[model samples]
Target: MFGIDVRTARVVWTAALVLLGLYCIYTMRTTLLVMLFGVFFSYLVYPLFTLAQRACGLRVPRTLVLLVVFAAVASIIGLVGLLFGNQIVAEATNLGQQLPKLLQPGELERRLPLPAPLEPLRVRLGILLQHLLEGGTAQALPVVRGLGTSLFHAAGNLIYVVVVPIFSFLMILEAPWIESFLASLAQRPDGRLWSNVARGLNDVLSQYVRALALLVLATLVSYSVTLGLLGVPFTLLLAGLAAVLEIIPVFGPLIAALTIIAVAVFSGYGHVWWLVLFFAAYRIFQDYILNPWLMSEGVNVPAILVVFGLLAGDELAGVPGIFLSVPVIAALRMFAVQVRLHRAARLNAGGAAQG
Candidate 1:
């Protein structure tokens, strides 16, 4: 047996405990992801609930306001589902049916020009394509099987959904208590520093969420209008995809537009020029107008920093990382600023007294 001193044994035990904790978290990653999303959702919607409280006057309790807020969200979801359900379903089905044709070797090769020197690569690609087409059923069977597996995985998650709202509501309801607890943990007796940090976080988070919502809406509207005007089939589905992709910040909208444009090209749409125009116009609008205005209003995060944060988040945590990274970075920035200012002030006063 290896000889170990008490301190070494304790350190080893602590490291083992830390590793065990990490393993446990990795196992429960999905639930933790959902919970984090739920928390952010609550943060985003808190202002609306507060506004509802004000609109109701002091007569109605805050609990009632939360209920109203929940109902409003649920109603909106239901209304959208009711209004667009058939169109969405039809467009999704149409897109699925057209996907194979769209992916044909001739269609892809037509779209992408290959260099003459890359003939060998092209030949290999052609062989791969032929193999894919010939063994399409074999290749697709696993994917089809995966759909059933995914459905089974998702089907009985009602309890999780129910728990999310409950947790969100509690987080919102206990917001004041949470603040009090954090305040108590502050280094300074006055607690002003922590209070400032808390307020800054709230303000930044609120603005960022609002800006994201507006950007998503703008993207959805612009994409839907353009695709509809171009007579693109599956317009609803593509527009919805654009809206969802809008959540990813810089690269998302471009990907959505390119995907839609590709679909247009493959569908034998006569006015591909119009589709190109739409994408160009939307890109201009987003770059010149919406993004600058929305981001400026949301947080004072530099564009470069936002991109860096996005890359880092994606590297660290994939999609969830991207979603959570922005606000977390902004909050950290605010805290850092507060700390620097406080330290500078204290140092200046001490220097003046010494002089």
Candidate 2:
């Protein structure tokens, strides 16, 4: 009104809106994370939903199919918990009880005998290890506490657990409606590029999520069997930890190996040397063969790019960022491809018009 140019005002308004939206995101990041995870899990659930519907020849109602699929997944989780949950808990409790004793001064030296050549340095070695462990644990306390708080909050919030599933269920059922809404906003006059991008992202996400689940299961089984056969203490506990951490890619298995070997050495396992060799071999097999085969269809990002993404993601958002970096990079790559296709189509149409 006060001599503002119309175009300038419009630009100002758009910028303001973007800033407001960013503020909202910052304020509600926790809710957004939950929603994001719900969307991720919906991709996981939808394929099973589709598969079950196909198995039933589409005779069953979609809602019924979804319910049965969810029920089966829940039942399998519950059954696994029933089978191994108590022992894992027992092992965790035992670890808590034993950790203080393990940290006692000279305990490392007493428990770990030096080779004859290094026998004189046993006390120094123990002292160095004790100082390092205490220092590291002290430095790590805040992160560990934050993680524990997050887990406790997730477990304690009944609504969150229910809400996440409800989101997945609604997403599956109302997918068409959601698509239409997004289309209304996203579709452009000159091209259907947005739709194509969405589809590519969907395919990448679905395949990545399913493949990741399979990888985790394989790690759990392989580690459990190998550790149990090797008579390693806390086989189930360590295996479960490895499986959970396996989602983080490159650093996950390394941490698991170091932790497992440290536990073996501290617990006086005789075959610690054998465990080291086995882990080294297994890491090679998993990284070079198993990971590539599983992720080939979905994510084609190079190993160097993946490592860089992990570092960038870790800097930006810590562990969750590291876990999501590959998929995010894949989606971005897909977006770039769609843009190139759109540009080429425009060029071809322009040439045709000139002809």
Candidate 3:
């Protein structure tokens, strides 16, 4: 319109549309997150859906199959929560009460006898805690004041939880159509290319999700059992937190270890040293044996790339980014491999044409 040529006008229109789309996405990020989570969950449960469909001789509605799968999952979660909820709440309350005292200026010194050599370090820590206490109190007042607002915000999360399952059910029902629609965006010659990429990405994501789920479940079960046997308070709560954090990689286990040790110290658990030793051994076992065993067949993503992806994802988008980082990295790696293969094939074709 502003004296632009046809090609230039088309380019300007495309750029404007792209920017508008970006703005829309940014505005709807929260809803998008819920939908993305639903999609990922659908990927994880797709195989079960197929099996259920087959069991019904492919006569039952897809929605019914989804409900069965959802019911099964919800029942397991509800049963576990019912079994341990009260104990976890009580232990969590006690832990909350103890944490402030631990962070107090002289609380650590009073609780733990320091050798003469470490006395200076203890003094420094006390001074640091004093400064932190002053700042923390100021920060805590605002949080306390906003507690009611936070409760309302939490209520909104209920909608998100409801929406996720609904989205997942819909996604499962339309999965085949979605695949075809995506593939059709490419021309005939490139449709197969798009389909292959989609298939590869789907396999990688599903395998990673399943492997991660198994690993987390094993960690939860193993830790809960071991800690309970060792007479740890809040074993269920501690183990559940550990399982959830296990998804975060490297620092997750470290934080979980610290939490258990802190609880032991506060609760007068006599086996503090033993608990520490156990966590150390467990970390070694998990990193060396369990994780590789679970992930090796499916993910096989390099350690360095995983760590880097986690850092990058966390930096960019926080927890959701962290959760999706591994899958995204695997998909990117798959795309790179396919691109390289395609490039090689093109070069071979060109050479034959020249011959």
| TM agreement with the true structure for every prediction | 0.75, 0.89, 0.81
Weakest 10 consecutive residues, lDDT, candidate 2? 182-191
**Runs in model 2 lying further than 4 Å from the true structure:** 1-7, 113-116, 176-191, 303-318
Which of 2 and 3 is ahead in TM-score?
2
Cand. 3 Cα-lDDT: 0.80
Per-model CA lDDT versus the true structure: 0.78, 0.85, 0.80
Per-residue lDDT, model 3, residue 340, is 80
Each model's total of backbone clashes? 0, 0, 0
Q: Pick the candidate with the highest lDDT.
A: 2
Instruction: Please give, for residues 1-355, the per-residue lDDT of candidate 1 as tens digits.
Output: 5676989999999999999999999899888977876776787678888888789998988888898898898899789899998899988898888878767777655543356888658656655765765697688888788778866876777677777777888889888798787777565646767777777787787677777888888878887887787688788899999999988767887788777766776676667777778778878887788777876543756778879989999887766788877787888888888888778877898899999
lDDT, candidate 2, 172-287, per-residue tens: 99987867866874667544787778878988888788888988999999999999999999999999999998988778888988998887777778788788888888888888
What is the per-residue lDDT of model 3 for residues 1-355, given as tens digits with 9 covering 90 to 100?
5786999889999999999999999899888888888877787778888888888976787778789988887798799788888888988887788777676656654544346888778777667756865897899898776776867886968988888878888888888797778677555665656766777787787777777788788889889988999998778889989999888777788888887886675565767777878888888888888778766444677779889999999887867788888888888888887778767877898999999
Candidate 3, residue 224: CA error in Å? 0.8
Off by over 4 Å in 1: 1-31, 105-156, 179-187, 190-193, 296-308, 352-355
Best by TM-score: 2
Error of 1 at 41 (Å): 1.6
lDDT of 3 at 60: 81
- What ordering of candidates by lDDT runs from best to worst? 2, 3, 1
